[model samples]
Target: MQSWQKVQCGVLLSISIAVMAGCSASSPYRDRAEDYRHAEPSHYELPPIPGQRDQMPIPQGSTQGYTGDEFIAPRPESMQTGVAERPPVELRKDNQGPWLWVNTGPAKVWPALQRFAEEKNLDVVYTNPRSGELMVRADVGGTPAQRFSLRQGVGRQTSEVRIVSMSSGQALPFSEFDRERMMALEQYLLVTQQQQNGRVSLAAQNLDDGDQVRWVDRDGRRLLVLDFAFDRSWGELQNLLSNGFDEDAQRLDDQDRSQGIFYIHYLARAERDSGFWSWLFGSDNADKAKAYRLVLTPSGDMTELHVEDASGQPADIQVEQELLDWIRRQLT
Candidate 1:
């Protein structure tokens, strides 16, 4: 029995040595916890320092904080009370029959033409806004294949649209077809103009008169001032004079844009004696249409429009004022 006890004690001692060896192999950082507990403290506590809670002083009349009723956001630099408005488009024809005019710029009209072409399913062959030209292939049902060319008007803010038919692969003047297309374009422009009339203002207003037209006194002569370029103003003036006056009573007989002169005829309102008896009586004293010249002179940014007699002399003050007033009334 004593021999058995000694053998058992040796086995127990070997087992204890094996277990300690296994634990030391698995836990290499076992001494780190003891080392940390025995280490000196690195950080020191700081004492509280007194300071003023309110360092910045508020202005005498200012509040310390925002009030509930105060407006927190800044005011806008500009206020938009309403959308600007533009005039309705007016379609007109010049003395030259082949060209038609629409009272809008090429920029606006070009897009509208594109939209029209798209709606009609016409294939656009070429389009150049810079050159103010468009060519399209019209192949609508029940109509022969055609090619159309649209050109912008001479003025910056106008369009002189034209169309041509394709015959034997060549372009030919399509007067009737051109008129039809022009009418259709006119309808589109009219609708768009009306729609945009409430949203955009195209004309620059004169601060002095609150109108697009103004008057200036230059070199002892009163001149009518138009807030448009020479080409546009000239076209608009021509349109106004042609349509605004009584039928056949007032007309522009001749014009030389290069020379800036328009020869106009204005007949008196009194009825002229006519027929065989009146012809036999010799109605030489009857009032006849007087010829006048409208001279456009560009001075810097604005164009000066002055009226003169056919002999190239300045019109009388009364005649000038009367014509100027009439034009102003018509334009405004």
Candidate 2:
């Protein structure tokens, strides 16, 4: 009877221990937390230090000053938000005919034209990506059928798109309807986004007839050769001279279309020599003004531009080169 009583007492002690453990687990840190009631409320929310019970104090001059303030992250420079700029598209006409001048390669324009045809519900009768040409018949909805000839431009990364009405296998003259269609294409190109694939068609690139301008050396002198005829070259040069050429501003002095010569005065930015007294006393660097003559010579199909001094003699080598380079840039 004594041993059984001892066993019962041991079981009772185990139960009491378990009850106390459960009560402490329910509010493990209640007593310790009440001891620190006077401390700041934020102190209790800080991350505890590794192997340490105490939390670290907030550093002086920290972001704590921005408490209760709304923050906005800045946008990165590479991440553009607004509508991006589209490729350049222009409808141009010359003595040849009306054509669209798009500042892009034929490869890109080929796909764009296909997409346009699909969107307009036009029937693509034929497509020759090698020749950079697409023959589409837009006769649907009582619209007159037309054919277009797309070709690579003489300049790099440019295309010349031409259109005409077709009837009985004969192409008609460019009409108002053709112009309207061309304008729509131009607008489409202007607004639509283009990819930067840097694609080039070998055959289409070969279709580029020739360069508009070229530089050649003949008889110990450099010449700016234009692939255009003399009349066209003259008209182009006149237009360029009428407008300004560069930031320094080259002005026309005299011109004689009969003689195919233009005299222009060029002033470097340093030679401008503008000052408070310049208007009254003239510029001290007025003597630095350089005058050059642009002489056009017809060579079969090409026109050559020869730079000469003010007196009509051979221009200084360095000055002639610089003038030739500037004129080439303007022409191209």
Candidate 2 has what TM-score? 0.53
Give the per-residue lDDT of model 2 (tens digit) for 40-68.
Answer: 66545678677874476775773421335
* Model 2, runs deviating above 4 Å: 1-87, 138-145, 166-171, 193-212, 227-248, 252-265, 268-303, 308-316, 329-332
Q: Write down the lDDT of every candidate, Cα atoms only.
A: 0.61, 0.69
Models, CA RMSD each: 22.0, 17.8
Instruction: Mark the 10 consecutive residues where model 1 has the least summed lDDT.
Output: 200-209
Stretches of candidate 1 exceeding 4 Å from the true structure: 1-91, 95-100, 138-160, 164-171, 197-236, 247-292, 295-305, 310-312, 317-332
Encode model 1's per-residue lDDT on 1-332: one tens digit a residue.
99999999999999999999999989857556668677887888888768837678785773322345644342231232111232445445443344445555555656666677788677778765555555665465534445444444433444556555665677665567667876776787788766654332222111112355777776777779876567666776776665554434356677788888888875433333445886687654224667888888776666778999889998765457556766765555
Q: What TM-score, to 2 decimals, does candidate 1 have?
A: 0.42
Q: How many clashing pairs does model 2 include?
A: 0
Tell me how candidate 1 scores on lDDT.
0.61
Clashing pairs in 2: none
